[model samples]
Target: MKAMTYERFGNADVLELKEVPDAHPGSDSVLVQVKAASINPVDYKVRQGHLKGLIDTVFPVIPAWDVSGVVVKPGLDTPEFEVGDEILAYARKDFISNGTLAELVEVPVRTAVHKPKELSFEEAAALPLTGLTALQTVRRAGVSAGQRVLIHAAAGGVGSFATQLAVLAGARVVGTASERNHEYLRSLGAEPVTYGDDLVESARALAPEGFDVILDFAGHSAMQTVPDLLRDGGIVASITDHRARDVYGGQYVWVRPDRANLAELAGLAARGSLKIEIAEVFDLAEAAEAYRKLETGHVRGKIVVRV
Candidate 1:
């Protein structure tokens, strides 16, 4: 099978298109003939060796974790899916080896879920990682109805999903984005604030007393203000910095794959409650170019790669 592979840790320059051995499913997994895959920040970070100390990696690694495809074969021990089943998965493992940017991928049955019939393969591929990240982060922050919620990087992949889910949960959402995306955020039922000098003040102006919840998807110093932005007993969650625990008594969230959550999201998408925005699409052979675009760090939603 052909895939985007890297010989060693580096930038997008290390990735190349190459034909490799076919990926076979493990006893509890399923072999998916990938129709589409999605790129996430973690893909590039792994390529750059930023996660070297964390997840184990094998040489000539395939890069990506989100995939939507049809099952060509189900593992001997996996009865959840059979041949011809269309599915989607956040195909992450304890170690980084096989990945989703390929013609075929082996996904653990535990994390693979039935694809939402209402979604195209690209749309199905786009949902798993970012949607789960946003959903779990919001849940960790314990967002609820009538609360004031603030989301950083509100127009980016995870942020967009977070904003919508928060609104659906009945929270008054305040999202940070450039002025160009303010209207974009508003359409998602969020009040937008520009990200800059007076971000905290701007956020304060909206909720004078303090926000009930703060979720920061944008790393860097944007979270430095969370300690001051929240109302008493309010919670904070950060996907970028675990140090949020020390600074604001908040949770630092890392999204994990869960079939139940994915299926629930599939239901939401099917019902028109969850919207996925595809910023761009690339062919599987163009994985390197896709990584270049992702590294720019400004995609409004998800980027998909058709296989």
Candidate 2:
């Protein structure tokens, strides 16, 4: 199979297109003919060796985690899917040796969920990692109807999803983005605030007493102000851990692949209760270019590599 591979960890320059052996399915896994895969910040972080503590890579590693594809074969012990079943999954980076930046991949049945019939492969591919991250952050913040929820980096991958999910959960969503994304965030049902000196004041104006929940995906030093922007007993969750320990008075959010959650999200997408945004799509051969675009941090939604 043809795949995007890296001989060593570094910049996107290190990735190349090459032929690699097809992976075999394990007893509890399924081999997917990958149709689309999304790029996450973690993909580049792994390439740069920044996630060494969590991901130990060998040379010629394939790095991608979010995938939407069809099952070509299901493992002996797997019954969740069968041949030709379309599915979306947040692949467990540990078992998939090679990531989704390939023509095919083997993912555990537990990590794979049925794809939403309402979405195309590209849209489903974009949902896993970022969707899960945003879902977990919102849950951690305990956002409820009528509460004011503040989301940082409102236009980026996870942030975009967070805004929509928070709004759906009945929170008066407030999101921070550049002026360019303000309208977009509002479309997602959020009150948008531009990231700048008066961000706090702007947010305060929107909710005089401050937010009831703060979820920060843009772990910049600015996240440290989230606590001050929250009402007492309100929660705060950070995807990037802006070291706001002093003011958190809440929980830190770390995303994990939960098949049940993915399944629920799939249902939501199918029911129109959630949305998946695909900013762009690149052919698998253009993985390097995809990484370059992702690093720019200008994407309105997710970027996918079509396998």
Candidate 3:
């Protein structure tokens, strides 16, 4: 199998597209014929060696989290999937050693879910990590109907999903993005707010009392605007700040994969209650370029790589 891999963490420049041996599944894992995969900010961060501590993977790593593929083989006791089943998954962090960047990937059954019939493999590939992150954050914040929710980086991967999910939950959604993405955000059921100086004021003008729940995906240092935009009793969750225990007295979200939750998200997509936006698509050969775009953090939605 051909795979894109990094012998050592440095930058996208260090990634190489080359032939690699196929991966075999463990007792409770499934071997998937990867049809599509998506690039996340974490992919680039790991490429650049920024997340070595968090990911804790060795060198020569296949870097990808979101995968949509068909099961070619199932290991012993893996009852959730069978050969020939179409599925989507957010591969676990500890297993980054062999990822969906390859023509095939083998993962534990716990992370896999049936793909939404309404979504193509490419679109389904784009949802897992980002979708799961948004779902977990909203659930952690106790987002409910009639409350106002604010999502930072609303035009990006997780933000796009978060906005839609919050709205579906009946929250008045407000999202921050550049001027160009205002309409797109609004289409997702969010009142668009721009980021920059007085960003808090922009959100405040929309909801004078502040948002009842704030989910930030704009990175740790960029989440400084969250506190002011949140209602005093509101909950705040940031993919940027996982250790926000002291920073936000409410809840802090640490995204984890849950097969049941992934299934629910798939159900939402199947029913048209959730939307998966693909801002860009790249071939497996263009994995480097995909990672580059994710690092820029300007993509309107997710960037997928077709295997």
Candidate 4:
């Protein structure tokens, strides 16, 4: 099987397309024939060794976690899935190797869920990590009907999902983005505010009383505005910054794989209540290029790599 492998932490230049051993299912895991995989900020971050202290790296590492593919075989203990089942997963393991960027990947049943027929493989591939991150943050902040919510980076991959989910919960959403993405944020049901020195003023202009919940998907000191933007008793959640909890008495979210949450997201996509936008699609051999585009940090939605 051909995969994008990197021997050591570095830039996208380290990624190489080469033939590697084929993957097989292990107990409680499934071997998926990859149809598509999506690129996340973490993919590039991991490639650059940003997560070295947290996750041990093995040589010749395959560098993606999100996958949508067909199951070619299931492990003996995996009664919930079978051969020929189409599924998607955030296939992160305790260690870094055997990822989904390859033609074949071993996905644990704990993280895999059935892909809805309504989603194309590309769309399904785009949902897992970002979708789950958005869902977890929103739930942590207790976003609900009639509440005022603020989302940082509202036009990026995870922020896009968070914006839509908060809106569906009936919250009035104010999202931060550049002027170019303002219209795009509006389409996702958020009142768009431009990010800059005047961000707090702009957000205050939209919601004079302060927001009931603030979700930060952007890490560049996004939590600095929490004191000014959140209501006295409101909650905050940040995926990028620990200050949301350590300093602000809010939650710092690390997205985990939940089969039920993935299923709910899939159902929402299938019902047309949630939208998955594909900013660009690249072939497997061009995955390094895909990472470069994602690192640009201006993509409106998800970048996918088709196998």
Candidate 5:
């Protein structure tokens, strides 16, 4: 099978299209014939060796965790899915090899869920990692009706999902984004605040009483405002900044793959309540170019590679 691979960590230039051994399912896994895969910032960060201490590097690593495809075979011990079932998965493992960027991927049943019939393969591929991150962060913060919520980087991939989910949960959301994306954030049901030196003041102007919950998807000093923005007993959660937990008495979120949460997102999408945005799509052979686009750091939604 052909895959986008990198033997060593570095720049996007290190990625190559090459033939590799085909992947098969293990006892608790399924073999998926990939239809689409999405790129996350973590993909490039992992390629640059940023996660060296957390995840061991395996040579000739295939990069990407989000996949949407059809099951070609299921493992002998796996009974949740079968051949010809359409599915999506956040196919992350302890090691950084055998990822979802290949034509064939081995996905564990624990991380896999049925794809919503309403979503295209590209849209389904875009949901797992970012969707899971947003869903988990919102739940961790315990956002509820009538509360005032603030979301950093609310126009980005995970932030977009978080914004909508919070709105659906009945929180009045204020999202930080650039001026160009303010309207986009508003479309996701958030009141937009331009992120900058005036961010805190701007957020205060919207909710002078202080926010009932704040979620940080952007790490660039976003946590510094917690003291000024959060109401007493209000919760804060961050996916990017660890100081939210260590210093601010908040939670630092690491997204975990859960079959139940994935199913909830699928159900939302199926009901036309959750939206998946595709900023761009690249062919399998052009995955390197796709990574280059992702590294630009300004994409509003997810970027996908079609197999």
Candidate 6:
């Protein structure tokens, strides 16, 4: 199998395409022949060793978590999948060694889900991580029908999904992005507000009484904006801020793989209730360029690598 790997933590420049040996799976896993895989900001962050203390790493690491592919081999006890089954997963592991940025990846059954029939391989590959983050984050913030929710970075990967899911849940959604993405957010049913100098006031202008819940997928900017945006007793959840919990008495989220949740997201995508935007698609060997583009933080949607 050919895959991209890095012998040490650095940047996209350190990654190289190499012919690696095939991977075998444990009894609870499935061996997937990769069709498409998507890159997240974490992919580049992990490549640069940002999460070094939290996640153990090995040399020659293949870095990625999102995968959309066909199951070529199911491990002995993995009845959830079989040969020829199309699958997708957030495919993260307890430790870093093998990943989905390759021609073949071993996915644990717990992280795998059937792909949405309506989505192409690239679109299916885009959902697992970003979609799950948005779903879990909004839920943590107690988003529900009739509630006014504020989402930071609403046009980016996680925020885009958050906006749609919040709207699907019947929440009045307001998302923050650049002016360029305002129309895009409106199409997704969110009231788009631009980010910058007066974000707090801009958000307040949209919801005078304050938002019922706020989901921060951007950064600590939420920490500064939450006081003005969230109503008293309103909840908050953040994937990017560790300081959010202490300041807002809210949840600091780290997304975990849940098969049921993945299935639900897939169903939503299939039903046209959720939309995935593929900002760019690169061939597998162009993974280094993919990671670099993802690191730019300006990508409007998911970046995919077709294997």
Query: Could you tell me how far off, in angstroms, the CA of residue 160 lies in candidate 6 after the best superposition?
Result: 0.5
TM-scores for the candidates: 0.98, 0.96, 0.96, 0.99, 0.98, 0.98
Residue range 151-180, candidate 1, lDDT tens digits: 999999999999999999999999999998
Expressed as tens digits, the lDDT of each residue in 199-307 for candidate 4 is 9999999999999999999999788888899989989999999989998889999899999999999999999999999999999999999998999999999999999
Clash tally for model 2: 0
Candidate lDDT values, in order: 0.92, 0.86, 0.85, 0.94, 0.94, 0.91
Per-residue CA lDDT of model 3 for 18-52, tens digit only, reads 89889988998999999999988877776777775
The lowest-lDDT stretch of 10 consecutive residues in candidate 6 is: 220-229
| lDDT, residue 117, model 5 | 84
Tell me the spans in candidate 1 whose CA falls farther than 4 Å from its real position.
none
Report the error of model 3 at residue 104, Å: 0.9
In candidate 5, stretches whose alpha carbon ends up further than 4 angstroms from where it belongs are none
lDDT for model 2: 0.86
| Candidate 6 off by > 4 Å | none
Q: Which residue pairs clash within candidate 6?
A: none
Q: What's the best-to-worst order under lDDT?
A: 4, 5, 1, 6, 2, 3
Give one digit per residue, the lDDT tens place, for model 5 in 114-165.
9978899999999999999999999999989999999999999999999999
- Cα error of candidate 6 at position 182, Å: 0.6
Please estimate how well model 1 matches the true structure, expressed as its whole-model Cα lDDT.
0.92
RMSD of each: 0.9, 1.4, 1.5, 0.8, 0.8, 0.9
lDDT pick, better of 3 and 4? 4
